[model samples]
Target: MAQLALDDYPDRYHLSNELHARPFPELTAPCRAAHLAIKQPRDAADRDRGRDFAHLVALLDRHGAPRPAPGANHYSGPLGRGFLKWEMHTEFVTYTIFADGVSQRPFSGEVFSLFPADWLAEAPGLVVTSCLVRVEVAGPDLEDRLGREVLSWFVPESLAVSQVVDAEAVVAADFRIDENGHCRVAVFARPGIGARRLGRIVQRMLEIETYKSMALLTLPTSRGVAQAVARLDGELSGVVAAMAEGGGQENKTLDQLLRMSAEIAQLSTASAFRFGAAGAYEAIVTQRIEVLREERIGGRQLLGEFMTRRFDPAMRTCRSARERLEELSSRAERAANLLRTRVDVENQAQNTEVLRQMSARAAMQLRLQETVEGLSVVAIGYYAVSLGTYLLGPVVEPVGIDKAHLSGLLVLPTLLGVWLMVRRVRARLDHGATH
Candidate 1:
C-alpha cells in the first residue's frame, strides 16, 4: 500500500486538499477580530479577480508576511500580532484579522483600524459590509456586568442574545451599524473551551453577519423588479382586453404583446443572478446559526427568531417577484399566440374569396374564346367561297355556268371544309397543352 502504482486524475489531489482549506482559526478567548467584505458595485460576479488578489497582496506586504502562491483564492498568515485571512468568493472578497487580545475600547475604532486607512482607501471595490467583534473569557463574578454591557452596547429592541453550542459560550449582537461604521458582535466563552471551539463560535458570528448582509442586498432589487412586473402586468392586461374587444387591431395588439413579453424576459434575465445568490446566502445564514444550536438568553430573541420576523419577509418578496415575472411572461406569450391564430383565420377567409373571383374570371375567358373561334370560322369560309367562284367560273363557263352561280353553289361545301379545318387546329392545341 505504501507505493501503489496507479494512474490518478489530475485534480484528485488538489480537490482532496481543498477540503482542509480555509480551516477555522485556532483562537482563544480575549481576542479581537475585524472582518470586511468588499465587492464591485457593478459586475462584481465577473470582475477581474486579479485586482482582488493584488489588493490582498498589498496588505500582506504591509505585514511583511509570506505571500500566497500566484492565482490562489485563499490565504492565511501573520499580520502584526494577529492572523490575517483572505478568501475570494464568486462576487466578493473577505478579509478577516484576528488578534490575540481585545483592545482597551473593544468593538470600536481600534479593531477596525487594523487595516491602514490609506490601504483601505485603495481597495479594489467598495465595502459591502464591515464589522468588529470581541471574544472574552467568561468569569463567574462578571456575569451581572456582562449582561448590563450587552444592553448598553447594542440597541435593546433589535438585540439577539443566546447561549450556543451546548452553552459553551454566549453570543449577542444588535445587527445594526453603530456610529463607528461597523456592526458589533460580542462573545463570552466559558472556562475550559478549547481554542478551536472558541474560534468556531466567532467564525459563525461573522459568517452570519456577512451572509446576512449579502442576502439583504437582494431586497432593493426585488422591490425594483416588483415595480416593473406591475407595469408589465397592467400593460399586458390592456392588450388582452383589446384582443377580446376585436377592434381590427390584432396586428397592433400582437406587436404590443410581443414587446411586453420581451421586456419581461429581459427583466427576468437581469435579476436571475441576484435572486439566486440571495437564496444561497440566506440558506447559509440559516445553516450557520443552526449549527450553533442556540437557546434564548434572558428572554431576549434568538437569531433565528429575529430572522423569521425581519429577514424572511424580504426573501419571500424576492421569490414573489420572480414568480410574477415568470407568470407575466407566460401570459404575454399565450395572448400573442391567440391573436396570431385569429389573424391567420381572417387571412385564410380573404384568400378563399380571392380564389373564387379568379375561378369566375377563368370561366368568362373560356366563353369569350369560343365565341371568337366561331366568328373566325365564318369569316374564313366566306373568303374561301369568293376565291372558289373565281377558280370554278372558268371551269363552269364550259358547262353553262358563271361566277355568281359558282359562288352560291360553293358556299355549303366551303363552310363545311372551313369548320373541319378549325376543329382539327383546336384539337392539336388542346392536346399540346395537356402534355
Candidate 2:
C-alpha cells in the first residue's frame, strides 16, 4: 500500500489522539483494532519514506498474522514526521506519537469529521491523514447521536441575552446560552422628556448606543427638540422666578437652583449624541437644533425688554436735539420772510427818494463850486497880469514908460478872459448831469 502524507489530509481531520480518546457511551464494545507506532526520522533523505513497512508487519504479527489479501485495503500508509498510522478492520485512525524528547502543548480537543472513502474516490494515489470509520448501523438518529457525543466534550456554564428597543419596536438583540440553560436578559430603557424620573432614566439610556440614537429623532419644526430644551429652560426660569419673588435678594437656595439648572442645560445639550449612532453627524445636528430652539424662544420673550433698555440714552439725546433744531429753524425762517417782504415792496421807492435828495444836494454843491472857481480864476488872472507888468517894467523904463499904469490896463483884460473860461466849465458839468 502507498504511504500517506500529512498535508494530504483536509483541515477538519487533523484531530490528535487526545480528542479521539474522549469516552463516548454510544460506541459498541469488542471492536477490532490495529496500532502502528511512529518515529521521527534522524536522516533527511529517509524522512520522506514515511513509516517503516516493517512496523506494519510487526503490528500484524502481534495482532493477527498477515493474510494473503489481494487488494490495497490490508496495508497501512504513512503520515508526516510526528504522526502514526493504524487500521482497525475497515476503520483507520492516525496518531502523532514521536518520542523526540521535546515538550509539546496539548491540543484544544476540537475535532472535525470527514468521509475519506468519498475523498479517495475524488483523488487517486492520495495519502490522506483523515480516519476512515465505518459503522454497522444507519438511521435518522445518527446525526443526533454524533452531535450529543461531540458537544459533551466541552460546554460552558452560563449565557446572556440582550435586546434593544425604540419607540417603534425592537431594534437589536444578542444571545448567549450556557450549559445550565440560564440566561441573563437586558432591554433598552427610554425616558420621557419632562418627567421627574427622566434624569436617571436618561443617564442609564446614555450608556446604551441604540437607545441614545432613538431618543434624538425629532421633527424639523423644533417641537421635540424644543421640548427637550424647554425642560432645561424651565428649570432656569424657576430659579429666576424664585430670585424675583425674593425681592432680588441673593438666596443660597436660588443660587443652588441656578447652578443645577445650568448643569441640566449642559447635560441636555451633550445628550443629543445619545439619540443616534456613535460619531454620527445626525447627533451633532440634533444638538445644534436644540440650542437654536432655546435661543429662538428666549429671544422672542426678551425682545421688547432688550429694545426698551437699549434705545433709552440715544432716544433722549435725539429728542432734545430735534426740539432745539426745530425752534431755531422756525425763528430763522420768520426773520428771513420779514426781510424778504420789506425788500420786495418798499426797496425801490426808498432808493428813488434817496436818489432825488442826493441830486438836489449835488446841484447846490455844483453852483457853489462854480462861484468859488470864478473867484479863483479872477484872482489867478490878476496875479498873472500883475506879474507880467512887473516883468515889463524894466523893458518899458528904457522907453520912458510908467509900469504901474500898464499893470492896471492888463488886469481888466485878464479878468474878462477868466470869467469866459469859468462859464464854459459850468455849462459842461450841467450838461453831463442832465444826460
- Who wins the TM-score comparison? 1
Show where candidate 2 strays beyond 4 Å: 1-343, 398-401, 421-435
Tens digits of per-residue lDDT, candidate 1, 1-435, equal 597688898999999999998899998888889999999999899999999999888888887889999999999988877889899999999999998888777676575666899999999999888988888988885558556866788898998888999999988888899887899999989999989988899989999999999999998999999999998888888888888889998878878887888888899889999999998999999999999999876677998998898888988998898888888888888988999999999999999999999999989998998899889888999999988987778888998988888888999998999989999999999999999
Global lDDT scores for all candidate models: 0.89, 0.36
* Residue lDDT tens for model 2, 1-435: 877665555545534643553221122211111112122312211343323333344434433544323322223333222222232221122222211111221111111111123432432122212111111122345335333532242231221111112221011111122243211111122222222222222212222222122222222213433444455445545545654465533435435554554554454444333222222423443343232221122112221222234323333333333333334334334433543454444667778989999999999998998788977987889887988798888888877778887787778887887778777887898899899
TM-score, prediction 2: 0.20
* C-alpha lDDT (0 to 100) for residue 196 of candidate 1: 93
Clashes of 2: 6
TM-score of each: 0.91, 0.20
| Model 2, C-alpha of 230: deviation from truth (Å) | 55
